[model samples]
Target: MFYSFIFILFFFNQVKTKSIVSINREANKIIKYVNNIPNNTWKAGFNFKSKQLKEIENIMGVLPINEKYTQSLEDLGFAIHHNSNNILDKDFNEIEVLPENFDASKQWSKCKSILSVKNQSNCGSCWALSTASVFSDRICIATNGSIDNNLSGEYLLSCCTGSCGRGCNGGHPEKAWKFIINNGICTGGDYGSNEGCQPYSIAPSAVELSFENTADTPECYHTCTNPHYTTPLQNDLYFASKVYTVKPKMKPIMYEIYKNGPVVAAMKTYEDFFHYKSGIYQYKTGSSKGDHAIKLIGWGEENGMLYWLAVNTWGTLWGMDGIFKIKRGSNECGIESRISGGLPKL
Candidate 1:
């Protein structure tokens, strides 16, 4: 009896230790660390604590924004460095008085796409989603709210081959913008809404937003995914007139969003960011994760700190109903580093 009792206690102890390790890997003990910070600007919670480490990595879905030229490309193919000198000239003079808090949705109340908060599901398609979102907004704004529609991120994810990078694994933000201008995309709504030419293939889920990168990027198709939708494939296509990367300065970025609606941006992600609940977020402490693309909608001041308002792809249940505010002007987490947007070919 004594031997059996000892064995039972040892087994339970081992199980306890394993459980602790799993939780740490999932949450990185971010809650404890974030709670300990003095005058914490943001609150931490178990937003992704139930997720596995691999799942968390999948959620941070953007490939490195700055990739080095590879010998493989030179050997098999050539890189296309589009001329940006003319496009960069499109930047407007510094606005004398920018609004304290300006939202694209509020500015363009007639453009319904501005109010959308999409979920990228378990796929690494943040690059495509943000690109499609910005394009949709720009289309509406450019056409004076006449062509209000959600362009298909699924088209970009599945059809934007080669330089755009792998669909679900990751993609480059600059290449994505270039793809929309070159190979136009069709309109599509969230998964299973059947509202457009090619709605997002990945189904929406409440609990499984950031599972491992198992969500399959659907095969590229020319026809509308929704059988009931009447728009022809070629007619459904929408193209951009111009695509360019905005300067990573606050003035340039603010001016772009103010004039052209939202712009897509890439930000370096850290483990602590998964637990973000509210307030102006600044990296407190955690291991650097990876790059993730997001849409910068506007800017505002909070508690003496200025922050850029951003939209996330992880669904409305997470992070201020799928939106967040990060410290602005300081390049916090490289949020101000790379911004890209385009004009819709209305």
Candidate 2:
């Protein structure tokens, strides 16, 4: 009866994606937001016994994920492949294609600004993640890397103009951008004290402040040399290629997250994501492919075992100090199928 899909909003009175409460408050409790992973439920049960886990381990050669049936862990967020070795389909190392040599001189003013995630679990905040990333990038563009800053994640989660709120479940990237372009975003330090997003007032008013702009994107002619750079986003480099342009209707927001860093993103949780403690995953019967709102920095093959170098918002407790590599290929997480684009556009 472990309907793993029974998330916080579906099972509880919670309106998805409200930010986490403080440590001393009940608002932030993962249980308050979501339901438990029922041991008897099929989604929770998975019909897999220790023997099966062992078999999966033997056959797949990795540990399977286990949960305390807790709400936070109930999502079974994502799973790495059991035998992950070949993740990238096409390999192109564009060293000289980078925008800049990743030097401080080339720093975008908004590079220092960061939007905080602030633990909006189970609310499907992919929208917020996308919006925040855009605003954060814009801050860099506006500042030209002169200001090492951090934006407010709580603000984006709670505000971000129109394209967000009520949790992480819904919103659009363009809407978020409209708000930022119309109204200057507050710095993370102004909200909390870090460069990431922070809690603010009149959460929804910012959405009303959203407006339009006519600034054209400068011709993307700048170039540099950095072996870490990838090109065209897709086309066999990184996961997949993402193309952007500032057309009459499409105002492509130009910003760089990492020259080449593996990004750890939250995925739509499903039955298979559980039993991932062993660092391997098997294809499941659902469309649980990664819908990464965030991008990783880079990836590497260790002894033929490829691991995605990713940055996380989990505060360094889970995975390697808030960073871990997922199984690359072999149908583990189907990451090969879920390619996010982040290449140098020189």
**Index of the highest-lDDT prediction:** 1
Please give the lDDT score for candidate 2.
0.31
Tens digit per residue, CA lDDT, model 1, 1-346: 9999999999999986787578666574677888778898888776653544445677566787334533432332222222223324344453257888888888988899876888887778999999999899989988889889988999999998567888888887677777777778899999888889999988875563437545787799988888979989898888887777777788778877887899888999887888888888999877887899999989989888889999988788778998899999999999987788877776
Q: What TM-score against the true fold does each predicted structure earn? A: 0.86, 0.39
lDDT values for all models = 0.80, 0.31
- Which residue segments of model 1 deviate by more than 4 Å? 1-21, 24-28, 67-95, 206-210
Candidate 1: pairs in clash: none
